[model samples]
Target chain A: MSSKYSNNLIKSADFIQSLERGLSVIQSFSTEHSTLTVSEAAAITNLSRPAIRRIFLTLESLGYLTSDNGRYALTAKVLSLGYAYLSSKNIWEIAHDPMDELVKQTGESTSISVLDHDEIVYVARIHTKRIMTMSLGVGSRLPAFATSMGQVLLAHLPSEELEEYFEQAILSSYTNHTITDKKQLIKQLEQIRKNGWSLAEQQFEEGLSSVAAPITNRNGEVIAAINISTHTGRNSRKEIKEKLIPLLLQTAQKISEDLARSPHPMNL
Target chain B: MSSKYSNNLIKSADFIQSLERGLSVIQSFSTEHSTLTVSEAAAITNLSRPAIRRIFLTLESLGYLTSDNGRYALTAKVLSLGYAYLSSKNIWEIAHDPMDELVKQTGESTSISVLDHDEIVYVARIHTKRIMTMSLGVGSRLPAFATSMGQVLLAHLPSEELEEYFEQAILSSYTNHTITDKKQLIKQLEQIRKNGWSLAEQQFEEGLSSVAAPITNRNGEVIAAINISTHTGRNSRKEIKEKLIPLLLQTAQKISEDLARSPHPMNL
Candidate 1:
């Protein structure tokens, strides 16, 4: 909904169609289809087979893809593209120590993420638990409507922006606990804004609960959010409220204070 | 050097110039240049200002780039691109527990990486110490010849392939302790092949020491390597050999066993 200007840009003579198609092909590969044939890629991306083949060959030549017989799998060089954004931000340098300390204090998995469109993308993570059913990492994404960090991020959005988000976001239920009703979700976000923190009990995944606090910039605008995630059986809601929430808020505040000291984002 | 066939592929009509240029622009933004103006990007990429402006506009339209006046920075959508490769491999699900255990056992930083074109790209990691100068993460890359993981991975390469590696690799010195001499480097590889592990003391970085072991596939081919990295001053050379080496080797072996149990990589 926010990218309506992209329609005009897509029509511009300067817009690169081949680049979009090439990235589309790369995105086509997933857990279910780690490798794909030219035909499979064409069918998935709605490109011609010849066009898909050429893109695959170009990617393979560039060391971003590997060909095994006729099927093409992505190479590790793809990591460089995503890492560019993270490295530019110096996220690991800033977030690792604080998140690691939070994990040590809470003995739960901790993560930091920024709001990306309708989802939240994890930029940094410190996992203390090995047995979480959710096997998430740095690039993992979760629906903004169904996770504590997402709620915190969404809560910080300007009212009109939040309205646009609610209008466009697909409120699909991941679990029975997920808030799919728009009105109900709005109430939760209002409460989160007032409380300065949020909790999601098995909303994203069954038997998992997490509490999150907003991370802000120098001007006190929310830039990102961090969470302490735990299994519901291990940490009851009462203990989470009494024990983990305070530590989570303190870590979030500490990280925000550090971000305030950074020079580049000061202009914001 | 290995991409001679790519020259012919580049000549093909199927090769997409726009795709390559777009990716190059994305790669140009780094720690030093977190954001770039059109002029700066054109200079770095050697594209015309008009062409660069169009590409930047296209990237911004695609939600891959964010613009403030004339300066542009990458957005988190780029994370999804690099994450595609990591998610396809399910790296965290397999490596996290073992790496966490290794960090606990050794009280040091531990990481797993795969060899990508003579460089080791970190695939998984666990951190216990707070003050290591190396602020590393999943997508970090380091020269293979100068680091323990790189050495272990290189040691497992076929003889001709190893020769080709030596033929093309840039053996520039990172520190005074680096083994830039080819004869000496080959001798060390031979010993590492026999010893089934590697230790690099202040080669890649000053005051850092690491010991690594190969993680093999089900068929006994080395696929990746894991390392226990610590301060050379904190753990003496002799103490590293006597204490950390055995624990590091055991952790690597445990990971190799778990990897062997997987069914997909069995075909390798």
Candidate 2:
């Protein structure tokens, strides 16, 4: 992590290290550490006390961070950054009702995710119930090689990009059912690309199963993936494929059509 | 706006102007301007093209922004910042089911918002249907003095803060029912605080009405407000007050309880 941070610093003469440090300071506040002292932030970001202090002060002045009794925490202004990303895409607006309908039909958690490097970042979601051991939400990420949505997205990437990804990705064994073998994963990706959907049963986590379909743009380029995730104990793999995949596919098509119709296609 | 921007730059010796400018550049990209040229960004931010170009290049290198045929656009990596904010709060996670229940029971749009300066920033939302002229999602901002959630939040502020707000607020007239007079607004706030909830009839937009209640922390200080917004044409103010207020208040109390039970209360 430190090496990558320094690499970014050296990548460009104009790369603002202070900006990076300031964002890191904001990111340091998490569910476990909502409030942090300068020392704590410094420790997390591996920056100097003065550096952290300056960043904290600047953020506080901007109303993105607030200090109370020497402990710094993020304010609602920080949410605006997320809002910018979400509102720009307008995916939530388009996917809202469709996700709700999917959740209602499946009686399971439904989400839409986009590929970010080697991970799938969930952008929109509607939960029927908490079915996963790891809590997931709008911003949660999972390994791209092991999950249904990730595979669906990865399957749609250009061949050269897919090859580049295969070369760089670390296919760690997340569960007993995880496809850690590169060749096997590549084969699955090919099948998913041809079939227009992907399914994973206990690949990333034990007992969690999901079926995902690609959402395309007007040009038919895969822009995002939508999925319905459920527990394996409640429904067998065949049951999910039979019961949920059709609804999931229909919803993805609807979102894709909406995206095509929207005036702001680049935002999606 | 330019004066305020410069004022922040001059506030502290340690204030990172480059950091602020970099973030502003990111925030400049919106649904309307998802992709921006260096000159376009410079025009919006009042910064030089060279400075904007450097920031854009730096952001692209960091994977938060990408250059496509000379136009820079945000990547999914940008969503991580918002994710950091949303994940830290855990409010959406806690409120998801309850908000869904509220939407189901009331058949209206339900949302939770927190006061930010003179605006209310939506943090979590569950929509039954589109009810307003404007489309709203998490991270959307509404005038605090004109919306039911905003009024509920404003009503609970400390007297000194409320006085300061009243003194500084512009009290723009969004609709005929919008509270434009500071004195009248204060009187209404007093009634809302006393009643433990607020109801606004077409205060923000025509044919829109809402009922809101404060969600307090374990310390009994109001941290957020949750509301149910409906079309006034479909339901009368008395009907909303008699039916939705009870459920809205109950949901807010439930969320408040869950927030108090959370390990990290500062984020809420």
Candidate 3:
């Protein structure tokens, strides 16, 4: 096939600026604004409506975005691009087998998530037959204070970094059981470090409870966390602590072993 | 956040040209060539080595790519950019539930895949207890003729477009079971239209079998295919025909029902 448009942007740095703008246009849509009219995109990106329309047209042409009734949103093509990233990165490849095994052993909804800025982004999820009440996905993100994965990852932070986290703002409560206070969250994180696991009961959202333990590398550095979420009505804290905790820790250990063995350098 | 540098490429189309060059530099690496030296990137993209080096430096600073031992490749940060694309889409939200039900009914692995040029790209996959030996992944692609999903999608093509597919080049055989003859392949696609599903046994790869059925909207246009892949050792062609065919058809029906019920138009 002809490689007409499939070469490097090496002539000038101008392409870098356009590339950044294109990415920014894509970043404009979120949970709050799933679909937006062209004018709305113009307002959101602060680009002229005409410019936004052209970018939308190009994106749509590229099969990354789609539009209807004057509104534009992303398409499954974007997911393939994400898949490209995930598939190329050996982290998911190595982490998934252990995750699947963990679900088999624990009979709980297990997910592996990494910190992305302020929120915990789920990279992989393994759902047991018993898990049906709550819905979670690979790209799903939740607040750091309200999810077990978030707490365990937070627990690994240095003391100075922890202080900077608290200085940002008040933690908004998702449920009455959520830790909204910064100091209270810090205390909980410290306790999580001591226990080597985190349990969030009715914290992120009511009726949902989860337990998470950090997955570390050979250096004993926490890179991600594995969590199992069950409905609050299904299991007690003591039962989960006894039954699920050992399995989660074992899974984390197996993952760490795999990570250390492969040492596959990530190429995104 | 401020929307800085959000203009369309038309304002400075020269910048768009440069962006294309930069992207070419990034896209030069693949599964086969995960890491490359500056001269290799220049050779692959047909750009000067110094120009490639500067773009590489900028991309490394941008956290998109990384370098070590004078070899450069992408990083995990690329997943974030691709995830940005997925977070902006709503189709997966519409498609996820039906997919779960499909997996529940069929013990085989099922996925929703779309056409990206000549290759069929898996957008989503629902895997059950059985370990999939094949490397077919979310962003993974395969020759359309060698895959059931690809055939179902190919059947939807117009006559001229179908001719374009035939005109392309020799059909590379992935397995002894793969269909290489154009005349026979065309007949099989016609059979898929009559039978309402496409089945392939070790066509794409050895020791794997799959059946794919099309998911259409109210307009009766095929948008995507629902497929179930199982190990050849686990089931024979006769067993698959009797047990899996009906279940596969049912899953396709469920996806179609959900597709019809969706309020948003199927722009993809």
* Chain A TM-score for predicted structure 2: 0.89
Q: What is the interface RMSD of each candidate, in Å?
A: 4.2, 5.8, 7.8
Error of 3 at A72 (Å): 4.3
Residue range A1-268, candidate 1, lDDT tens digits: 1332223355568788888888888889877677788999999899999899889878877778877668778877888888788777866666768887887788888888888878998877766743322225667798998999999999999887787787779999999999999999999999999998999999999999999999988788887899998998999889999899999999889888888886555211
TM-score of chain A of each: 0.91, 0.89, 0.84
Please tell me which predicted candidate would have the highest TM-score against the true structure: 1
| Model 1: how far residue B147 lies from native, Å | 1.2
Give the least accurate 10-residue stretch of model 1 chain A, judged by summed lDDT. Answer: A1-10
**TM per model?**
0.89, 0.88, 0.83
When candidate 3 is compared with the true two-chain complex, its DockQ is 0.25
- Output the better candidate (1/3) by lDDT: 1
Q: Tell me the DockQ of each model, to 2 decimals.
A: 0.45, 0.38, 0.25
Poorly placed runs, candidate 1 (over 4 Å) = A1-11, A129-135, A233-243, A266-268, B1-11, B129-135, B233-243, B250-254, B257-261, B265-268
**Clashing residue pairs, backbone N/CA/C < 3 A, model 1:** none
Superior candidate under lDDT, 2 versus 3 = 2
Task: Considering the two chains of model 1, state its CAPRI-style docking category.
Answer: acceptable
DockQ of candidate 2, scored on C-alphas against the true complex (2 decimals): 0.38
lDDT of 1 by residue, B213-244 (tens): 99887778887898988987889888899988
* Root-mean-square deviation per candidate: 3.4, 4.5, 6.8
